[model samples]
Target: MKITSTKLIAATVLAMFFVNNSAKAQSLPESKLKFGIGLDGILPVGNLTNTANFGLGLTPRLQYGVSENVAVTFTTGIYHFFTKEIRIPSGLPGQYNTMENKLDLIPVKAGVKSFVSSNVYFSGEIGVALQVDNGGGGSQFIASPGVGYAGDKWDLGVRYENLSKTGSNSAGFIGLRLAYGFGL
Candidate 1:
């Protein structure tokens, strides 16, 4: 019989790799279908000045499992913001009316969620947003990053989103969400 140091080292590394992977596999959730809805409250920043101040919105999501701990998500949401109001001449003489400032955003995105632990996860999304207001409407690119705790039937998370407009400026906000889902 013979024993070598290099062989022993290689064997140890291989064993450790398998043990780590098995532990991760054990913590992964089973694949299934899930649906959830959430709400977001945001404060505008950067290029969104004058056009947006504060916002509140709703998000509805559908997720389909691809692996034990991985899922593909389809999401859409809308946010409303009150910006700056301007005074305009009313139809009657010597009368001025204040125009209300409101901006609405609708985003549709496809994303992937990966569970890193039994109850912890991270996700990223890229999509397009339809921006509408009293003046005119346009579309822009949107990106989002999120992290949260997920359970068997519910989850809570926080996300930061960036909406890039055609011009030089961009709009962004941070939001919190609580969602519930069921397996099928």
Candidate 2:
């Protein structure tokens, strides 16, 4: 089933409220710097689904705790999308030719992570995604909002990311990230 943005936001808020109310409160890491690397899997949505079957990403992030329950983050990543084969009708009857297409992107973002409970957090980011392919496509603006579980050394998150450019349709995906973090 397709998830609408309103539903996603409502779900996240409900989860945060329940977790915060039911779980024992714990302190967030304060005044500390941490680094993490994440492996991401994405399912193409919206216009992206037309061309890409799936995507994989490698992202590295740096976080600095600014308060008891808030952190500022910088993240960069490379994402590659595996595309479906496109079939074109050949001159011969009942014959077709297939061509493969792929897309590569580099994203740079800055965001904030806010802990609601001890181990659950909400995050949001805004950035630019630069398309690096033979087509020489330009950059697009990106926005992502997510919710996650963060333990001492591991984190798992789910997010919706949208990329858009002027005069063009938007593209997006629902993504999951698994990461390992360490204090720096």
Candidate 3:
């Protein structure tokens, strides 16, 4: 009898926890989807050993609530990276006025969102980052993550992107995103 009572109590607690989690799953302040535009700073890390130069980019995003705390977002944008220094195996640095690796990326992602309070929410997206160009170039695969806040008229975001798909293909891409959203 004691064992059964303990199991019942545990089940009740677990059910309550799931109910609470299901309620706190979104960041939007209203009932509609949001459309946003923001600035981006995409930079490569540890590439030019002694180089402090970084890349600049821009992003436009669409966010919809699959649930209160889970959102599906699709982002498409351009990334420009300038390299004043790049470390070589020769133990020296090379300079490039413009790196041809700059690209246009369309990231299709689904993110889990948790509303910290009323107006602010933390979110993360893990999805396919597809690369394409206007010059009839090729495409590659990337992984992306983002965190943002919802405002009265807009949403602000910071994102990390990974595109260097070599070996295990684990490279890190970090950037900032600022956007404004409207309902559908």
Candidate 4:
């Protein structure tokens, strides 16, 4: 039931992302590379045991535009965090600990985006991610549909990503990237 709801929400967001196309095309500079950073806060929606300590996170990414509608990205950093209050039943005094509880994943995704109208786009990408904790193995498939405006020097976007992956449970990290893309 949760999976079904998640899929439905993803589909609706994608539909909104593709709803218009008549805006002007903002030209990019000679360089195709763009850089961006974002703040992300998420609760474990489909897989998890706790939502009590799912703190906010951040992801920074860089992308190179292949054309107006296609791009590839490399993200060198991501963080998962938590804060837990521990109580000792026997020995140690009770304490509150804020554990950023970080495990970083560096991912490179080669993907494409298509503008449904001038300001809305749909994107899909697949890539390998190296789990920075325990040397475990994992990979990801992220498909996002977004709406954005290309400012004179940057692109501002809001997107919903259906991020599927392996090993997040053991890795002590969240399973996805919900982000904003900036054209560098």
Number of backbone-clashing residue pairs for each candidate, in the order shown = 0, 0, 13, 4
Candidate 4 lDDT, tens digit per residue, 1-184?
2344346446654654454544334333334777766565544433432433564546576766655544555554554545344433554477444443334445555554545544455544445555465465655544444445544344455544445565553212233335555554
Q: Give candidate 4 misplaced runs (Cα > 4 Å).
A: 1-23, 27-31, 49-52, 55-58, 83-103, 134-149, 153-155, 160-184
Instruction: Give the winner by TM-score.
Output: 2
Each candidate: what lDDT?
Answer: 0.71, 0.84, 0.54, 0.48
Error of 4 at 5 (Å): 10
TM-score, per-candidate, Cα-based: 0.73, 0.84, 0.61, 0.52
lDDT of 2 by residue, 1-184 (tens): 9766556656655654454444443233678899999999999999999999999999999998877777888999899999999899999999999988868999999987778878889887789999898686689898888989998889899999888889999889989999999999
Model 2 residue 76 CA deviation in Å = 0.7
Kindly list the per-residue Cα lDDT of model 3 for residues 48-86, writing each as its tens digit: 213335766666777766655546666666665564533
List where candidate 1 sits over 4 angstroms from the true fold: 1-31, 86-99
Model 1 scores a C-alpha lDDT of 0.71
Q: Give residue 94's lDDT in candidate 1 (0 to 100).
A: 91
Candidate 1 TM-score, C-alpha based: 0.73
Q: Who wins the lDDT comparison?
A: 2
Candidate 3: C-alpha RMSD to true structure equals 10.2
For residue 171, model 1's alpha carbon misses the true position, in angstroms, by 1.4
